[model samples]
Each structure stands twice: as structure tokens, then as C-alpha cells.
Target: MTTGQIAIIVLILLGAGFMLISAIGIVRLPDVFSRMHAAGKASTVGISCLLLGAGFFFLDEFLFYRMIVLIALIFATAPISTTALARAVYNNEPALRRQLRHDEMAGSVAEAISAPPADGDDAILTTPS
Candidate 1:
């Protein structure tokens, strides 16, 4: 086989391996946060490598560009979505929050949780005298 073909195979295999590891992590991990972390980081790399391999296989300009865009979008959004999900889970699940060994968001989360919900009568939206 050609070197290009070999490289594509390697990329695809590596991507599959990463995705498999991510799946294992999600299943084996003790907590929701760890599982989400595994799913977020490993799956991003896995999907990117898979897309790269596909782009190489097709070697079409349009497909190549689309692959690049897909990789970029995954990299851009994965962490953001993961963090948002984690925060949502943490805020909603007290038991999950207790499982955290080191939480940088503890202060902010505590304050947010303790803070009273704002009503529509707040001065921020009202005209000042």
C-alpha cells in the first residue's frame, strides 16, 4: 500500500482507539464529572483524527474544507459544552458536588446557589431619578 494509505489507516486506527478509551472511561469512572471529562477530551481528539482520515481518503477540496471546519467546530465547542454540562450537573446534584476532590468553582457556585432569585422589579432595568 502507498504511504498515504498507510497514514490514513494509522489515523483512523488512532481515532478509534481514543474513542474506545473514552467509552471505557465513561463506563469505568466513578462519577459523572470524570465521565464527562473523558467523553469531552478524548472524543474531541478522536473525532478530529477520524475526520482528518476521512478527508485524506476522499482528498476532495470540498470534503477537505468541510473536514477542517468540522474539526474546528468540535475543538471550539467541546470544552464549552462539557463545562456547561458539568456545572449544570453540579448545581443540580448535591451528591455529585460532594464527590469533587478539588473544585475551583466552589466559591462561585456557593454564592450563586445562595443568592436569591431576582424579580422584575430590580433597578437595573428601571429608570433612575
Candidate 2:
């Protein structure tokens, strides 16, 4: 009924909507990469929004700081975890690329790790080859 209550309701609805959409995306997407993109990215946003809404509803200064810190931590580490999971999945299935739209880290990391230039094989000495 009140304005503040209305705002909290709207924020919660938006967050829940994003989470539901992301869940659908994971289930309906054609491939693993697309599913990861949806679930990983959208869920992070949804959770942040939910926390933000809860912060306002709780109406406490300390709680607000805690909410902000939680959101910050989510923003900080989520992408790294998502990338690591994606890379793990990709290593086991090279064919993942065929279904993906545009893979920025397609070959470089894997190639660099799989076969490094040997010291004796390449013989790329600083002084002489």
C-alpha cells in the first residue's frame, strides 16, 4: 500500500523474473555454452537485485552495508568462476565451438598450455639459436 512497500515489491518481482527467465534459458538453450551464458550471467544479476531489494526493505544502516558488500563480492568473483567452469567443459568437448556464436578464448589458452615451446626443441636462446 505504501510507496516504499510498493518499491520493494517491484524490485523483488524483477529479480524473480530474471531468475525464472535464466532458468528457462538453461533448460531450453541448444548447447552447453549458451546454457552457461544464461544461468551464470543472469543468475548473478538476479541475486544482486534481490539483495538490493532486501536491503531497502530491512531498513538498517549496517544491513545496507552488508548488502552492498555481498553484491560487490558477487560481481567480483562470479565471472571468474563461470569462465573456469566453461573452460573445464570446453576442454572435454572441443566440439562446443561448433555450437557457440563467438568464443573469444577459443584456442589460445588451451594451445599455450597443451604444447609449450621446448627449450631444446625450439632452441630460441637469448644469446644464440
Candidate 3:
């Protein structure tokens, strides 16, 4: 096999390994936050690597550009979405709060939760007006 072929195989294997680890992490983690952390980080990397390998294997300009765009999108959005999901889950679930070792957003979350409604309605709105 050519060197390019070998490199593609190696990258694919590495990507698959990362994805497998992500799956294991989702199953083994104690809480939703930890599982989201594992899935988000690992899946982003794994998918990027897999796309990179496919680009190399195809060796086409169009595919390479597409792969780069996809990788960039994943890198840009994954963490933000993960953090948002974690924050929402953290705020909604009281049980999960006890499992946290350190919560940097604790003050803000508590303030948001406890603050009275601006519109004098019973339902509190977390979103800024």
C-alpha cells in the first residue's frame, strides 16, 4: 500500500478509537455533566480526525475544503453547545448540583434562579430582557 493509504488507515483507526472512548465515557460517567463533557470533547476530535482521514484518502481539492470547513464548524460550535447543555442541566436538576466538586457558575446560577420576575409574573425568566 502507498504511504497515503497507510496514513489514512492510521487516522481512521485513531478516530475510531477516540469515538469508542467517548461511548465508554458516556456509559461510565457518574452524572449528566460528566457524560456531556466526555461526549462533546471526544466526539468533536474523533469526527474531525475521521473527516481529515477521508480528505486525505480522497486527495481532492473540493473534499479537502469541505473537510476543513466541517472541522472548523465542529471546533467552533461543540464546546459552546456542550457548555449550554451542561448549564441548563445543572440549573434544572438539584440532584446533580450535589455531585459537583466545584461550580464556577454557582453564584450566577443561584442569582438567576432566585431573582424575582421582572414582569411581576410567577414564572421567572432567566433570559436577560
Candidate 4:
């Protein structure tokens, strides 16, 4: 086999390995946050590597552009999606919330939970006299 083919195979194997580890992490982790963390990081990199390998193997203009767009989309959205998922888990799952060592959004949560509703009739507006 050519060097390029070998490199492609290696990259694909490495990507598969990362994906396997990510799957294991999702299964083994104690909480949603940790599982998301593992899956988000590992899967993003894994998919990227796999795409890179495919792109290298194919080496066409259309394929290259598609791969670039896919990679960019993954890079842009993965972290945002992970954060959103974690926040949803945090909001919805009390049991998992307790497993967290530090509650970064605790104050915001408390404030939101404690804040009273603002009724139109209760609004106090003062104009500069």
C-alpha cells in the first residue's frame, strides 16, 4: 500500500479508538455532565480525524470543500451543544446536580427561583421632574 493509504488507515483507526473510548466513558461515567463532557470532546475529535482521513484518501475539490464545511460545523457547534445539554441536565436532574463538586450556576439558579414576578400594575416608573 502507498504511504497515503497507510496514513489514512492509521488516522481512521485512531479516530475509531477515540470514539470507542468516548462510548466507554458515556457508559462508565457517574453523571450526565461527565458523560456529556467525555462524549463531546472525544467524539468531536474522533469525527474530525475520521473526516480528515476520508478527505485525504479522496482528495477531490468537492469532497475537500464538503469536509471543510463539516469540520467547521462540528468545531463551531459541538461545544455549544454540549453546554446546552449540560445546562438542560443541570436544570432537570436534581440527583445528578448533587454529584457536581462546584455549582457554577447556583447563584443564577437561586436568583431566578427566588425572584418575584413583575406585574404591570406593580411597575414603578419615575420620570425626571
Model 1 CA lDDT for position 49 = 92
* Clashing pairs for predicted structure model 2, backbone only: none
- Candidate 4 lDDT over residue span 1-129, tens digit each: 999899999999999999999999999997777788889999998998899999998999899789989999999988898877876666556666656677666545534433333563212121111
In candidate 2, stretches whose alpha carbon ends up further than 4 angstroms from where it belongs are 101-110, 114-129
Deviation of model 3 at 116, angstroms: 5.9
**What TM-score goes with each of the models?**
0.81, 0.78, 0.82, 0.79
In angstroms, the error of model 2 at 62 is: 0.5
Q: Local distance difference test, per candidate?
A: 0.81, 0.78, 0.81, 0.78
Error at 109, model 4, angstroms = 1.1
TM-score of 3: 0.82
Number of clashes recorded per candidate: 0, 0, 0, 0
lDDT score, candidate 3, position 74: 87
Alpha-carbon runs more than 4 Å astray in model 1: 113-129
- Tell me model 1's lDDT, rounded to 2 decimals: 0.81
* Selected candidate, larger TM-score, 1 vs 2: 1
lDDT of 1 by residue, 3-83 (tens): 999999999999999999999999999888888988898999999999999999999999999999999988888889888
Q: Which lDDT value does model 4 have at 57? A: 89
* lDDT of the structure predicted as candidate 4: 0.78
Query: On residues 30-79, what C-alpha lDDT tens digit does candidate 3 reach at each position?
Result: 88888997899899889988999999999999999999999999899888
- lDDT score, candidate 3, position 29: 92
Q: Give all candidate RMSDs, comma-separated.
A: 7.5, 7.3, 4.6, 8.2
